[model samples]
Target chain A: MRWIRETGPVVGAITLALGVGAIVTALTGYSVPQVFRHLAVGAFGDWYRLAQTLTQATPIIFTSLSFLIAFRAGLFNIGAEGQLYMGAFFAAWAGFSFQLPPVLHPIVCLLFGAAAGAVWGFIPGWLRAKRGANEFVTTMMLSYVAINFTSWLVAPGGPFHGTAWANQTVRIATSAQFPRLLRGAQLSWGLIVGVLVAFLVWYLLFRTPRGYELRAVGQNPLAAEYGGINVTRNMILALTLAGALAGMGGAAETLGTHRRFIELFSPGYGWDGIAGGLIARAHPLGAILAAVMMGALRAGGQAVDRAGVAPADLAAVIQGLVILFVVAPELIRYFRRLVRRKKLGDIEL
Target chain B: MEILSFNLFISALRLATPIALVALGETYSERAGVINVGVEGMALAGALTTAVVAYFTGWPWLALIAAIGVGALLGALHAVWSVYLRADHVVSGAAINLLVLGFALFLTRVIWGWRGTSPSAPTMNAWILVGVGLFLIGLSQVYIFRTPWGLRLRVVGEHPRAADTAGINVYRTRLAYTVLNGALCGLAGAFLFNNLGRFTDGMVGGRGFIGIAAMVVGNYRPLPALAAAYLFGFVDALQMRLQDYIPSQFSLMLPYFLTVIVLAGFLGKAQVPKALGKPYVKEQG
Candidate 1:
């Protein structure tokens, strides 16, 4: 009953968003029913589509977890995109540069990715904690810097540029790549790892004394400080942990899916993760489900493209509307107040 | 001497126009205790409107007005969410950004059979807008600092309860300034469209964020904010020239890096309004 009450608004927002998308589709001279049918078929029609949906769901799960942990600590780590890129690049670099045994190779590369992301996260964290800088702007700025820095590394004359004509690194060794779970689908062990990490994050955020301190800081920093919680250290720790999580996501993408560090690889997965975290109301377990929903929308958008129903961007429209509706639940409360006021006036008359 | 030529100076001023306009607009909104990070999306929406209207009507002035109208509409939406609905300002702004991007992409694909780019359209003189922006910034300095209404605006943001006690309408002031901010962002978009005579989704890029940075560097004052915009504009112009000697990617990172550094140095020191980002709840009798 509690779960249903909490998710009631989320469900309503999703339904409203889809309704808005349908209206948009109709206005654009497309059949709404056909477009939605294709969306459903594309997202869950068969094993292959289901695999694709899970595959898409994998990275966002990591990023959403990243957003959630930082949010719980009273910080916004929007720099997951940059951290992911750094992690992916380093993970790929490790994959191609060294020759090691099968199990150990991927493990080392993942560690390298996480370490790099931690370093990236630490800079803005330290700045915010020590120097009174705004993390929101700093994280965004650092994201642009990381993107450009990585792009330069893969461009024609950079050291990491592979012999391939495309601006991508050489493919990782077979020993470093993640084994595929399905015979003909893109799904890999990354999904399993992502789920495990989500559970771990839930435990850390809810079942630990440290987690309590962090939540206290988010709730009231001055009070937390007076209560003997080191607000600065917690802020730094939260962003660092957030970075590591996003870094692992990037590493998983490199090891399990891409097999190479491609230029400009992310399609705003970081931004999608922000929406995911909010949709889940910062709950770790709920983030996984929200991420899957986002992934399904993406998969369905691709399907819409193939079926010639409408442009794929229609999916983004629904996602945005969902965010707008979810964030403004107060709008509903305001309407309720207005109705009550009208009733009071009628009674007076 | 070769790098700081007359052309570079002129180009710097031109590049500074949009940032300065956004900074000026943000100054107003922030002064009224509302943070409007949706400037990026508002600008993009404005540019898209300019292209569509200009393409159909071939009237640049009408396109500019439409851009402003669309921007004001988005601003009104944001005000409703943040002020009345009491949503998080940043989240509401982020939603507007995402919504605008999706709508821009969809419209482009639907109308022009292109995903993100619009064809060349009829345009007016972009420098005219630049001149107008500079003029507004100058006038705003006087209006904000040397007028009776300016004191009321400051009081509303700094001590809203007091302002309300003094019979000033806090909610109306905030709504008006947010809408004004959005209209200014639209004008910035119109300038971009006029300068290029075309529109692309990525054209606005991070200029809007940088504009906010300039506002901080300027200490929330209009004239100083314009000066900060000019400094960033100079770096942008210099980077374009330096692109011949260095990788464009490395040069592109300079402005963002400088913004972070500049913001880090200036954030805590800025005279931030006392009631910034806090929703004022009126006590019912």
Candidate 2:
């Protein structure tokens, strides 16, 4: 029943994307059906394709969950992108610089990544909660700084520049790398871990008193403080946890794929997760579905490119439309209200 | 030494123009009570439109006008989402950025047959636009703080109920400012690319957000924001000139790092307008 209600808006967004894509296809003299057919086959044509989708979806799940938590706490933690970079960098530093024993190496690296991310998250949280700084601007600035910082660190003669000159760190040891789940595909065990983390987030949000405080603060900080909730502390905690989650995403990506930290590693997975959380209405479990859908679209874009119909950027357009279309219901309702006000002959709308 | 200093100062002003214009626009919106997070996306859209139109038409001036028009439309789209739909301001803004990015790329491919970069067009000596933007910034100080209309807008932003009770149209004021905000952002972006002679992906490079940072540092005031933009422009220009002295990436990171520092240190000192993000609904008497 819940899904039935949600499907209307979700379907509306999908329909709008498909409708627009079809119009463009028809105008450009391409087969609309063929484009879609390739889209499906590209996303799920074989086990390898499915694995690739899962591989892409893993980071999104973590980042979406991160956004979901902070958003639920009424704080916009736009610093997830920066936090993810820190996480990946710390994880890589641990993997390459340390000579830990085989069993403990990956675990320590992941932990270091989470800690780095949490510290990054905490600063903006502290500023926003205590100093009245806007997270929107701070996070945006921090992201550029972090990206460039990483670039500098990986540059020649800098701290962690690899021999390849590609602005990357050296590959991690075998024990520190995430084990693959499939024979030939790059799918890692991180996919399962990401799903487990999703479950943990669901439990934390719905079944914990700390979660109650965060939600209360988000809903009404004044009322929550009146009710004895530490609003400032809760806001900070919310951001810290969110940063930790996003950092783990970066960790998972490095441990799972690439096996090393690279500058500009993410193609906006952190930002895309914002769209994922919105599409899922901040539901923890629902984010997995949203992430996978986005991953499929990305895969479909590759297929479209291979088919010579459109560029891979069409995927970005679909993601963009998903966000724009998600708001379509509200737009329609607003217009309807305007019409009703006009019918009543009211001077103001 | 004098010639070098003059060249650097001129380059700084040129670099600062877009930031100042966008910050001024954002000041108008925030005073009327909206943060207008779509500034970056709006700027990106304007850049693309300006580049494409100039490329094909041989008229860089028309491109400038068309860019502002497109930016205003995008801003209006955001206004509709924010004002009428009563959506979360940040959410709407983020979505607008996402939409514009995809839409801009799509348009880029359609117009230029390439998604990476557009061909160079005729450069409009943008120093004139810079002068005009600065003049407008000076004029807006009076327009916002000294005029009766500006007073009403301020009241609506600070206390919409009070403004509404006093017979002011809070929604219209905010909607108008938000659109104007978009126009300035459009001008900022158009100016950035017009002088550069082409559009490339990621060319806006977070300048839109830096404009927001400038507004915060300036306490939502025009003169302060212009000054802040100049400071930032100076840092950016110095970094460009110091490419051999420091790692290029480190030099490039200075503006973002400094903005963060300014924001962190001035967190409490700088004040935002009250009722900035709240949606106003008329209560039944």
Candidate 3:
């Protein structure tokens, strides 16, 4: 019941905002009704679109879960982007460099990718926990280093370079590809893995002793310290787990979707995870749902591009609005209340 | 050899000016206890606005003012979200980045009808702009450390509760300094546009992040921040000059790589403002 009340206003506001956006578009010379109709059809008009949205949602789920975990432990983990890239790079390396049985290959590649992301995440987490450095700056800086390093690896004369100047790596072996869960659709076993991970995260955070300690530290590190929990170790562990999840997201995207490591493959999924985690209020299930909505918006917006209407930059606009509205609901509520009170005053007169 | 060194020094100075200006701008906001992580977004907005305004108006100075105004608008939005609404500063900052990026992309497509926008340069060259930047840097150091307002801002950062007890309005001070910071950051962006003669999407690149690094490396002192900026500038200039010797990719990444190493090594001991990133809520005694 409490959850219903909390989410109710968000849903209402989003619907109203969408309507307003449509009206604005109509007034400004685009057919808003047609655009929305097309978007609905394009996104869920068929099974293919549904599968594509689901497939896109899969990586977002992992990354958003990663963000939720770190945030729960009071760590920012801005390096998730870098960690994801590292995971992709490692997954690609494992997939392309090795010859293994089809049944075992994808699993091996994913684990390697997870390990790489964990290592990437661990650098800043350990630094913050042990040395008391600011995680925000360290993690953000690491992102650049990771991006550059990945670019360097795929450049000519680098270890993972493709045989051309096109700035991409060789395609992975067929064995390393994630098996399709649905025929004729891009949906893969990765979606199941992502859902399972979300449940595991929910269970770990809500039903475990370590989860209690992590939350305690997040709420008040000093209190947790006084309660005898190893705060630094927990911080490091939280970041490691978070990075592993994000790394798996990168791995899933590569092995399940692209099958090759390309420079700048991500359209800022890690940053999107930040927004997703915040929107979901760091709940595992909520993060999954928000990730899907975001994925849908991205896919639907791309579909709308085909229908003209300038594509609308709706994803970014909605993302910004959601954060603004969620964080400052009082602004909307106060205004509404003021209007109501003024109307009442006028009626009394 | 002397001329070579002189040219190197000039190049380093040119690179350092924008970073130093942005860092100094950030100093005011941070001193007033607000971490202006939107510096990147603000600078980007300022750069794009300045480029467009300068291109049409044929007046570089007016363009600078427009950039400052745009930056202040962005700062106001951040202040409302982070300070007034008491949202997470980092989250608000990230949203601002996304908003600016989206807006810039949309405006570019609508106005320029191209995927990218590049404006022609005015009369003032990079060297003249570098001179102006140096002058601004000197002025900022004096104004930030020496003024009464500066002292109050610093107090707000160091001990907001005490400052409040001393009858200072922490919120107002933060608002004022954030606007000031935005203007200075705008100036930095304007320099990039009017001086460099063209605008690229990645023009600001990671310089805004580098400015944050410089702030930390300098221990939040203005002169030291300038020195740190110059140090980074030297590395950047050196990378450009040595691109033939070193792989350009490695060169391009040099500053960021060094930042990670330096931050990992030294930032453990760096003491930030006590009230940084914490919204000030006046406590009733």
Candidate ranking under TM-score, highest first, comes to 1, 2, 3
All candidates: DockQ: 0.75, 0.66, 0.50
Using TM-score as the measure, which candidate wins? 1
Whole-model Cα lDDT of every candidate shown, in order: 0.88, 0.84, 0.79
Cα lDDT tens digits, model 3, B1-285, are 332477898788889978888788877788788887778878888888887887788787788889899888888877777777677777777667766766565556555655446646453465766777677778777877899877888899999989988999888888888887777777778877865786666677778778887888878778788898998888888878777776677878788777767666777666688999888887665
Candidate 2 structure quality by residue, lDDT tens digits, A266-347:
9888887888888878889988998898888888778888888776677787788788767556764555567889899878
lDDT of 2 by residue, B1-285 (tens): 332577888798888888888899889988988878889999988888888788888898999999999889887888777777777888888888887887777667766778857888876888888988999999998888899988998898899999999999888888999999999989998998976878887888888888888888888889999999998888878778877778988888888887878787876877668989888888887
Decreasing DockQ order of the candidates: 1, 2, 3
DockQ-based CAPRI category assigned to the predicted complex of candidate 2 = medium
Q: Assess every candidate by TM-score.
A: 0.96, 0.94, 0.92
Q: Candidate 1 — which residues are off by over 4 angstroms?
A: A334-349
Q: Please write out the lDDT profile of model 3 over residues A1-349, one tens digit for every residue.
A: 9998677656655665476556545654667777677666666778888887788788889888988899899888767788889899899999999999997999999999899999988988998898776676777777777888898899887777885967779999999999887788878888888889899999999999999988888989999999999999999999898889999999988898888898888877887787677777788988888888777766776687677755545445555556555555555565567788898875532
Model 2 chain B lowest lDDT segment of ten: B1-10
Model 3: CA > 4 A from native? A8-35, A163-165, A181-185, A312-314, A329-349, B1-4, B116-124
Better of 1 and 2 by lDDT: 1
Number of the candidate with higher lDDT, 1 or 3: 1
Instruction: State in Å the error of residue A250, model 2.
Output: 1.1
